[model samples]
Target: MDRTFTEHLLQWYDANRRDLPWRSNPEPYGVWISEIMAQQTQMERVVAYWRRWMERYPDLGSLAAASEEEVLKVWEGLGYYSRAKNIRKAAELILTDHAGVFPDEIKQIQALPGIGAYTAGAIASIAFNKVAPAVDANVLRVFARLLDIAEPVKAAKVKQEVEQAVLPLIPEKRPGDFNQALMEFGAMICSKRPDCDQCPMSQHCAAFANGTTGERPVLPRKRKAIHIEMATGVLVYNDKVLIQKRKPDDVWPGLWEFPGGCVEKGETPREALVREYMEEVELEIYPAEKITVVSYSYTKYRVTMHCYLCHSANNGQLKPVFNEAVTGQFVSPESLSSYAFPAGHRRLIECMLDEAWFDNLK
Candidate 1:
């Protein structure tokens, strides 16, 4: 079954393959970048981001030379900001430790920040043409059905079982293409709704023979989202609004946003904004008008941020003392787009623009 499965899958892959920009050349650096950006992101969206990122950074040297702020800006709207930071760190490590060359060995690549076992396997197989199994969501789904694993795919033990079963199927000469074919086959044919009739491996698939395709790859129950209410102030002085960079360890690290904190029990959003601003930045400003309310999700938290306009400065204390942020800046209304902001804060900016709120500040 294993040999026949391998032969059939490879033949099918040659006939039906995705024509991606990164696939044409498959350079080590380009493949690494594409793999990192593809995590938890849709392929269509990842294609555009990968193109923009490759154009901007070009190679490992340029990416290593870039500042965290610059990298974060380029990765804006990509959702996972830590991926940007991690790749930059990895790039710097490659330059310093390996003389700017991407590591060929899986162990060496895994030593880099944010490159886990799955990612390491992907890079080693796809970039270096090594015999490694890269098991992503797509591969896991395909494997669970092909091998007829009854346990939930999310379970660690089940994942290990799938990987072990797939290890021997990776061809020696074209291991990279083999891994990509498995990923593509999972994404296209053996998907959530597997087209059993069209699948080349249908005859070899244990789940199809047993009539348990849908139930083969058991999925875990979805977790409920936690709700959070937060408040922030847009304090303007001299036609500029004060913004703060979130602390490095905060939820939205390395991103700029209005200064605020979560609303405590018995406190209104307006009162929370004033108190949070005072406690966080030592800036005393009365919340004058409610500018915008934004709702966004991160991880499992569903956040609702109340943004207020603090048009006047109390006690003439314009200088900020940092607590919740690493640094604070008062930027012009027109320059807000220059900095990378959290999704909620970015939405606030869009809402203000739609309402022409910047004109009132001027």
Candidate 2:
């Protein structure tokens, strides 16, 4: 690696850095929150959420004192609900273990619930100005193209090699700026379809010199998405819908959704909904008209959900099976705003509103 590339990259960053909200006030707690929210999410989308979050919980003490429900409510549509839970857990740990102060050390930051090596490095370098490397997808892409690395970027060995390569370039005086410059360069110039012509480091980029800029950062082949079909019951009584809280071990934990489960191999959607409601809530529900079919994709599976309007048999009260961790309740449609729901269920709410199911209640 040549030093001139670093010099040009830094100069370009100084002249063209985006005016992000986190950059305006780079406190440790705010930086930590922004980094977590920015993962797998675009920066433009994260800005509003980050600002609202900062206003709601100004510091570690406020976040530490917040309940999981409150935290998830703010993080409702962010997807990846586990990150919200982990942030709360990390905040509590910081309060109890570190006296409500964000840890400055890289290892201590990584010790938090969801703070991985990348997040820790980001906070350490950006907020604390420590000589650390934050090698996320963007950084990996930038380095792979710059060095013409042909290995799969997702592989552990490739990642380790990139980290080793990055460590030597961290200037002691401006480590944070250098790290952010590399990240910004990747994001703006050297993306999946890079703007190689506009890149300040084009002369130094090995892949560009070899005319293989697009082919350098090779990734492993992705597995096919597993298809899943589900049936869900939208139980309404006196204008209130029965929603179940997902189990902590379940996907999208801490978020509420319509009561239902996967459709069995031979069962119809309505039959599956009836059976699921009986087993999970111990309530017999009569499935009525089909409300809507919703589809969503997770990282590994694609799901199609069949939701139906259901009423309790004989208007019987639900005897929900509740453990210490998971529970169910009936809440008015208006009250849904207070709880965080999965995107599919959120869309279901819109459908209900469109059908005027809650208009009379309002």
Candidate 3:
């Protein structure tokens, strides 16, 4: 363990750390929540979401008692809905298994539903002040450059090497602060474009000294963007729309959505919506006016979702008799917020609300 490197990192952190709420008053639950929220989300965005979440479900008891839909609704717009689901699941497990206390040991933390090695380390070290190494994407990048590692940092074997390297460097005293400093340093200074001038430990960075910082943290090439055409129908009967819960095996699984499916080859968006409704929910509907077209990207998939206002073709007989395989409901416009919807669907709702489209339901 290089004492100087640890010294420089913690010194910089003490001077320039972000004054986040979780840091001001550190605790297991709040720190764990913040770490989870920070995954794949901007720090600023996580801050607002985390604050709102803490206010509503402050303790494990509140979170464990909350309904799945309520948890999903609170976590809406964060994407990775599974993480939110896992958080609630883990909370319940803690209540039952750990007596409602977030585990302080690294192994116990890692055993929780969504807590991987990186997250486990973060929560254990930062929250409980356990002497554990926190190796996130930022830490990986920082170390890859520091050690001049040429292999892809994301490779499983390489990640293990990096994680092990940081282990011995975690000072026993204020270990949590040390881990946070490394994460913060990597995020603010040793980022993709290294701010060497601002970096406290620049002298120890092998890539910087060797002038190979740009190429040190080798990353895999990004996946090609796949374009998908989808159609969804808002089956209106009065002020209510028929919505269905997605199958657990489907993409964006278990979320509520307007009944729809992908536009197969050569099929029009209108035809796809009508066909999907019949197949999924046994509803024969005529696709009416186009409500809105939504364009969004998730992971490597780019979706062009054509949303439409639809009406029953069964001569105004709107009784939806769902079969054994389907789950659906016709809910009023004001009640849509009670369930969580995908970001694109939520945006479509925004458009629906703006024009009061429910007024046109026949």
Candidate 4:
């Protein structure tokens, strides 16, 4: 790679970089939080979450002391709840293992939960001025185009080559600025549909010269989304809805949802709901009329949920048998506002509200 590319990119970045909140005062804690939130999330959407999160737990000590419920509550709408959990765990480790100080060394930072190579490199270079490369998808795209490499960008071998290519370009005195500049450049000028006409690195980009900017960064083939059909029972007894708390290790840990599971083959939605309630809470339910259906997309699968209004088969005599991993409770319709629920369950709650079912309860 030409040395002029780094100089020109830095100049462009100094003039054109977005005035992000994390950029205002780049501290290790704040940058770490921002990086974690920014993963698989857009920058525009993350700004407000980052601001509110910083306000709630301003330092490592506060985050370390917070309960999982409190942490998940603050991170309610932020998908990938595990990131929030990992951040809290990392905070606690920093406090106890590292004596409440954000470690400046890349290895030490990487030792924390959820701190992978990309995140560790970002924190090290951006916050600590270490000569490290932060090779995220943006950087990968940039590097692939700059050198006009055709290897799959997501491949491990390609990533290793990109990291090596970027290492030599890191300026000794301003490694952080250079690293951030590369990321910012890729984000703004060298995107998937790059603006080559306005790009400062257009003259230096081999893909642009070769007229292959759009095709150089080869991505892995996408897997088809698996379609899943599910049924959930919204059991309302004596004006209280029965909800189950997910196991800590489950997908949406600690979140409340109507008791049910995926619909099995060769079974009706109603039958699935009855069986699910029995399996999940050990309570027999008489599945009633279909209340609503909701569709949601997860990372690997698309789910269509069939929700039904249900009643206890024993005429309210059956109480939920709480196991060690999962628990259940009956909550008033109005009180449901206080609990956090998955997106699909939240939609179910909205449907019940829209139909005024809770208002008609005797």
Q: So what's the TM-score on candidate 3? A: 0.95
The TM-score obtained by model 1 is 0.94
TM-score of each: 0.94, 0.95, 0.95, 0.93
- Report lDDT (CA) for all predictions: 0.88, 0.88, 0.88, 0.88
lDDT of 4: 0.88
Model 1 agreement with the true structure over 251-331: per-residue lDDT tens digits: 879899888889999999988988888899887778888987888888999999888888656555478898878998889
Instruction: Output the number of the lDDT-best candidate.
Output: 1
On residues 1-362, what C-alpha lDDT tens digit does candidate 3 reach at each position?
Answer: 38888888888899999989999888999999999999999899999999999999989999999998899999999999889989999999999999887888889999999999888988888888789888999999999998999998999988898888898889998889998998898888888888776677888899888988889799999899999999998988866798877767766777888878799998999999888888877878998799899998898999999999988888655767554224888898889988888999999998998988866665
In model 3, the runs with Cα more than 4 Å from the true position are 321-326
**How far off is model 4, as Cα RMSD?**
2.0
Query: Ten-residue segment with the worst summed lDDT in candidate 3?
Result: 317-326
TM-score-based ranking: 3, 2, 1, 4
List, residue by residue over 1-362, the lDDT tens digit for candidate 2: 86777788799999999998888778899899999999989988899999999999988888889999999999988898889989999999999999888999999999999999999999999999999999999999998998899888899999999999999888888888898998898888888888888777888889999998878799888898899999887887877888888888888888898888899998999999998888887788888888899998878999999989898885545566644228788898888888889998988888978887667541
**Residue pairs with backbone overlap in model 1:** none
User: Residues 15-65, candidate 4, lDDT per residue (tens digit)?
Assistant: 999999998889999999999998988888789999999999999999999
Clashing pairs in 2: none
C-alpha lDDT (0 to 100) for residue 135 of candidate 3: 91
